[model samples]
Target chain A: MTTLTHPKYGAIWFTLVVLLGISLLGPLTGSTAFVLLLAFGIAVVKAGMVAAWFMHLAVERRLIWFLMITALALMAVLFFGVAPDVMRDQGQNWGALAAGKN
Target chain B: MIDLLLKNASRSGVEIDKLFDLITFLVGFWFLLAEAVLFGLVFRFHRSRSPRALYVSGEEKHQKRWIAVPHVLVLLCDVVIIAGTMLVWSHVKQQLPPADAVVRIGSQQWAWVFTLPGPDGVFDTPDDIARVNELHVRSGAVYHFELTAQDVIHCFSVPAFRLKQDAVPGRLIKGWFAALEPGRYDIQCAEMCGIGHGLMAASLYVEEKEQHARWLQENAAPPRELVAFRFPNP
Candidate 1:
């Protein structure tokens, strides 16, 4: 039996904590775009760290890597595909345009 | 059969119905075919008075092809469905047609409040018309709504219009539809909010322009205690 240990684990934990702290301070900036970008970035980094280190994907075989990449690509496609509809300018008075047509 | 499924009152409702019919037909065909094949295989491969049974691990080239072919076909079906759905979704949701009116819907534990632009035709104004549990709009006109929830999450759904949107406490959602026919439709709270969720029902009246104008003139009065509610920080 063998036990594996890495000195980088402590560094990764520190980085995750720092990222979380930054995300917590995101709302104070009062900039929605900035907050959203920072939060999502932190989430992605944290998720990547977990998948690479905790889940041992860094040492996984080529087949596992291919499957993971395919899954991620599909998720990105789905998100981008649906984002256009939900992220429209709601403040614009579309009714005024319709009234002009009439 | 189509009429039995919520009456289509909006122009876009027709498109939605067409998409739904296409999906139903494809799914029904696939379901029947798959079930028939499953039953046929079960009967054909049933164990009878046989001396021995053949053991196959499906690792052979021929066996692998059988699995791969079906998998490819299933992937093709998925691609077709996704392509068709994205087209309709982009049309209905991404592209906003000219709207004749826009209203704000505020939902709480057990009630729905609709805010219509006043004579000035703008919301967040002192003159804006706010009604409880009654939404009035003109037929043959495109209408947009801004949805928000005061407390818990709720879903504003009108079956006849084929529209549903979530009202989140800290987020504003937009939804729109155009009514081609004039009638009274039911507005339901599709998401459960609280114990009073069952009572969270409203009425949507779509009438002729003249009739709708008259009704608005008679009932469009802003409540005295119209508090400006702001979205809470998450």
Candidate 2:
């Protein structure tokens, strides 16, 4: 965390509250896609705001960014690598997932 | 196997128990060995015996051998486990034999409603017998159950049969079991569905062919206006 600018916590909190309201009300549109998009898209923006301003990662060194990205990449690799075994409903030693054909 | 103590009750329960035994043995062996090695090392290199700090980085080839040997051995054990899992999955989940009797089971928030093919040996007619929290099946007969959730996700679990299947909302999951003995068993909702999930229990009756027929005859409804069974909100 090495941000040079001082953050206005009040404004940030106000923005987060507004985003939370929109996410909560997104389902009222009756579109699953819209609800999901608004919920997650706002979540991403909120997270970035917290990390960049509150956590003060905006002015961090390039090396810190690289390290963080590398950690995220490793997590992705671990998740995706095990996804096939986790998701598939095919047979293995004793049994497979209880995934039935519709 | 745990089934040795529980008395394996269904066709698939035997194989499932064997798999469970293999896993238990392997994991038990490894667990004991690891604990022994750790204790042995700790006792040998105690502070009272050796006052000087002896730091081992585990960078040397010989040091790495301890990790390597167990790594290979554990991998082999993993292979055995995966192989066993695949075989059972094929038999239980992947394959569904032709059913001697078909039952429709609907899971609601707090109860199970079983629709048995009535005396005419058919479903959805005026004679379909819908009972709450009770499932009756003939022993020695293969049964296919179409499981569905009325409102929320639930699990159809019979521990005696070693059967567990998720009853997801908007899905008809078909699973089968061949009854072995004529007895009564407990059916439990394995998944958390609502405030009353812990109370969502049922009874499974495995009756002889003749007994089941008698039950069907005794409970058979006369031809009348068809009415679907629905649970009032819990």
Candidate 3:
């Protein structure tokens, strides 16, 4: 047996709306770093709700789960491969990124 | 190579052109070879010549060589390009020659202001020559430019010189170039800053020694009218 969601579509949609409002209003508190972190946390919750209830990922079979995981793993490999060049503080012939050039 | 058609007037542009030519030759060779092989195969295997179809599973060692050989060759080409690029980068950027003259380049919305050392060859003095959208330099002299942006990020690009540098706001970026010949060149902003980015262009005048000295001496006198530089209260 395999599972990827809930049948309560209306309840999930309402919860998503509430999370959106909270995330938008969270910036007014003036603690930008803390509020942004909280907003991201809310976004993860909302995303999970959408996937499990709206998109029905929770009810999908094991094959669908394997496909999704493979896609995510490939994306991670791409990120790690490119992150070094993008985030390099000091690299050979990086005259533009050297100290005091910023 | 396009270098034969497009003129390169700077010291480092010569080295860059060599690298460009090498890459062009290698890539062009591979491109032509691949295309010829593709069309040749198509013509050789035309349906009229043979009614039967042959299956290619690409599992055999012979079939595998098709992918492996080209893959290794392309990687070798990549290595050559990377090595040449690093050498050019090192020669053009990492090593800085002592400046014979220094120019201060200030970029803002829709305009560029250049401050060159006048007859005295000293900045911030009465002899300093400041002009808007016009830069004058003497040929055969190494000039280091201090580039900065007043409003937003802008790039100083000279196509003939193959020189391009970004002018970042609140930062002083130093770069150098030497004009080998005396001529006028187009100076343009390569970075998009505002609505007037396209119009943000200037002229670089590289003059002969005697001509440059004459121009320097002529512009030394104080002007009857002064142009004021002001900033609004933020």
Candidate 4:
């Protein structure tokens, strides 16, 4: 029996594993920002790999690519559009501002 | 039209409304256009006159343009909206501007507990002022809040301030907003936590600078005893 094979699967899998390891070790840095960045970055890379290789999106039809791009674009609109109101800074009070000096 | 949507009390609230208006206009235009096209096609290709309809599969290169052109326009619209929104997002959410006041909000199933640093400007101390369901701040002053939930997840939302953050159990979320006007605003639990989720509401009083200071002083907790009274350490 013949098993299906892909030329880049092994390399992609290895990279994903390495990324997972890095993300797991990210918490050891004891920096919240660093850990968040590393985890998110790795997740994005891993997602891209899965989509490209496992999902066969790398060689899919143009229509499929178009649909995927459209979906992603819509998701971006949803995320960014709602973010402004959610993220606005509430200005500082006089007491708190003065306290920061110490 | 802006006032019809919601009351804008914060400096950022105005910007949020503007963004909302822009999005509404963009989407409204597309909605009308799509509806018009749908109605037009229905009448233009009516069954009475033409027995054979033009069945274009859109698989051919020439036929694909019918699908591609509209999709390209949609993509262009998406790009414009995303770019515009992201600029506002980075300004509001990504960059945490220096805040003059900090409040820690702990949410439970049916209540919000706000902890304000005392005169010494340190939290988790004996002098820390803790209030339930009421938060007071100075108008025009920037205030940052750290939010967390004691049990179920809750959202700390002040519609007037145009700010909302989820208070997840064991996770601290930070949010900030500045009230432009001195008024009492309602704080709603945007995320449903439990049976009494709808009842979980609070009031935010944005007062004058002088009034805020007086309120703080009046509400400040008395200093705690330095030594804990126990059974002589067992």
Q: Please give each candidate's TM-score.
A: 0.68, 0.69, 0.69, 0.65
Docking class of 3: incorrect
Q: How would the docking of model 2 be graded?
A: incorrect
* C-alpha RMSD over true interface residues, each candidate: 11.9, 11.8, 10.6, 14.5
Docking class of 1: incorrect
Task: Count clashing residue pairs in model 2.
Answer: 14
Per-residue CA lDDT of candidate 3, range A1-102, in tens?
A: 344334767887888898999899888899989798989999889877777667677777678878888998999999999876566543432323223346
Tens digit of per-residue lDDT, candidate 2, span B82-103: 9999999888987887889888
> In model 4, what is chain B's TM-score?
0.87
Q: For model 1, what is the alpha-carbon lDDT of residue B91?
A: 68
Candidate 4 local lDDT, residue B221: 72
Candidate 2: segments with Cα more than 4 A from true spot: A1-102, B222-234
> Could you arrange the candidates by lDDT from highest to lowest?
2, 3, 1, 4
Q: Put down candidate 3 lDDT per residue, B22-127, tens digits, no spaces.
A: 9999999999999999999888888988678899999999999999999999999999999999999877777768889988888889888887778998876777
> Candidate 1, residues A1-102: lDDT per residue as tens digits?
345555488898898899999999999999999999999999999998888887777776788989999999999999889766454423322211111132
What lDDT score belongs to each candidate, Candidate 1 first? 0.79, 0.83, 0.81, 0.78
Question: For residue B125, what is the lDDT in candidate 4?
Answer: 69
- For candidate 4, write residues B40-145 as lDDT tens digits: 9888878986668887777999988888998998898888889879977866776667899998788887988877887667876667777779888889988887
**Candidate 4, residues A1-102: lDDT per residue as tens digits?**
334457577888999999999999999999999999999999988998898889877776788989988999999999889765444323321011111233
